[model samples]
Target: MAKRRLIKALAALLAVLAVIGIARAGGLYLNHTASYPRGLWQKSGDYDPTHAGEHPYVLACAPGKSVRREFIERGYLPWGFDCDGVEALLKRIWAVAGDRWTVTDAGIEVNGQLVPNTQPLTEDSAGRSMPVQTGGIVPVGHVLLLSDYHPRSFDGRYFGTTPIKDLISEVTPLWTESP
Candidate 1:
């Protein structure tokens, strides 16, 4: 009986060590303040994690030109923009170059209909005034980003548009239970 108990304790210790290692290696603990959402997992075996905007996923800043103010369908890591020196974000790509876009007080309209959760915010949570973005034609090499899940998402409605040249790469969920 003593031997069995010792074995159980050793097993629990190993499990705890394994979990700690995974969290540290994956940088899960640092993700929150870092600005980038860590993907829980991939939805399926067939899904490729490297493809950009294939599905909802995380994004990491690649080494290149630092982006200025801009948000897309996917959330932007504060690091995506060099402003304020925040961390990176995760968002989706809604409209790419060649896609006609119009910005208004109500929200952003692609072609004609309004985008969900795009109603402009009068001010941020901190009560700072939010700037209104003027919409017209989407310029070449620019992509519109947004998130329908969150109405106040700091996306195209706020930042205007993202330059394609600034994109790093699309990240697939590390693991996902749902399809």
Candidate 2:
């Protein structure tokens, strides 16, 4: 009977620990939810853990209307805004201000060098055709967000460039993992 009681106690302890962990993961504090430092789960291959060490993260504040529309269509509210959408995004700087950027339906080139695996698609998942914006001088106060790792990443290839006004902060990953 003592052994059974000890086992039951251990199971109960484990259950409590599990609940705490789940609450923490879900941003819940006891019965309430914590609000600071909102967490975002990344499901796409645009950015990878391997590149985090090599690149300094740039948290851009500017999210254009097209990107906002795309996020809404995809059912992602990211920053908790109902219509305006996420005000900032953590993206690696693929092309910076004053760099010669050329974009075409075939691929993208930065400073005359073809960015690997950055081919623009003719159509998206919804069968809507994608537009091609020819390469041009990356204007002052604008940045391009693209990843060589993700062949099909939705980035500058589809949305063009991000203005500096939309940038909010440059952030380092506090905790990240791949599923």
Candidate 3:
């Protein structure tokens, strides 16, 4: 019995290591945050990372240093995602460049359609005041990102549109649990 248990543990460890290795080599990611579903996501084919608006969801660097700090300190972003000294943020491209975006009491509106789960909060869960974006046309090279799946997600509603250059990669869900 003891020998069997030891073999099982070793097998489990090897399986985990193999999964991680395959994920790294194949540009796959595991979503652990509630902002999206918790599961596996694979990066789309290599393309122009400069076209942030073209993708539905992207892995990006936090909009600014202060924003990154806030997310890290607040426990919103994971420390494990440190890439090139910057933390990664997953965002859904709500509005592409040239789309008119507005912030209202109800929620964020894209071209006059109110996007659900985007009502910017005045204060975070810890009572810290959150940044509220001013409404405007999405500037060139910028895309408005949001988390419609999670209301409290610290996303573009707080920081407005992000530059296309911030996009690290486009990804698609392979398997995920409902959020």
Candidate 4:
């Protein structure tokens, strides 16, 4: 009877361990390779990252969007490919630039030269042209994020610059081959 009880207890412990391992692996997989929209880019005007129920300011790629393929190939999932992705990339750039960059009313300036407004010069839905202002200095640990598709994207110009801390993580591909 004692032997049987010991065996059962050991089996239960093993089972728990297996479950935990699977959960952690699954979470890592989702973070790096999942292509589905996790509510990063919400069209709702009231979106707020600080609020529990509100969506974050980060941008994520649309489902089945071809742009995601490039990111996946580069070992990055479209984590915050929308607004957040831009922020992360900008942060990386800032990290590389170190003390040579500055944000201003005209836009980002590198060594006093305005960082060309890469975002397309266009108008919003209300017939008002989107503001070209990149705003403020690129302080240490801060980045000026923008969209890959500037003409059609609502990025830093729409939601403002994001701090490095706000960036969750760099997107990573789940598998080497197509799923």
- Top candidate on lDDT is 3
Q: What is the C-alpha lDDT of each candidate?
A: 0.54, 0.58, 0.79, 0.40
Which of candidates 2 and 4 reaches a greater TM-score? 2
Candidate 1 per-residue lDDT over residues 1-179, each given as its tens digit: 99999999999999987985686455432333322243353222221323433424433232223333333212343442222454444556666556677777777787686777677887876676765577666677666666665676666676667665544445455543332
lDDT of 2 by residue, 1-179 (tens): 99999999999999988986675466332211111123442223223334433544455533567767665566332543222555344456667767888885557888877877788888777777765467677787777876565565556776678776665444443444331
Tell me the spans in candidate 1 whose CA falls farther than 4 Å from its real position.
1-85, 176-179
Q: Summarize candidate 3's per-residue lDDT along 10-115 as a digit string, tens digits.
A: 9999999898888868888887787788888888753253564453777777677777777777776677543446446777888876889999999999889888
Error of 2 at 102 (Å): 1.2
User: In candidate 4, what are the lDDT values of residues 94-176, reduced to their tens digit?
Assistant: 11213344446555455565534434444655566554444455465444455332234434444444555555444333333
Error of 2 at 4 (Å): 30
* Candidate with the larger lDDT of 1 and 4: 1
Score every model by TM-score: 0.56, 0.57, 0.80, 0.35
- Say which prediction, candidate 1 or candidate 3, comes out ahead on TM-score: 3
- Please report how far candidate 2 places residue 117 from its true position, in Å: 2.7
Residue pairs of candidate 3 with colliding backbone atoms: none
Deviation in angstroms for 110 in model 3?
1.0
Superposition error at 84 for model 3 (Å): 3.9
What's the C-alpha lDDT at position 15 in model 1? 100
- What is the Å distance of residue 67 in model 1 from its true position? 7.9
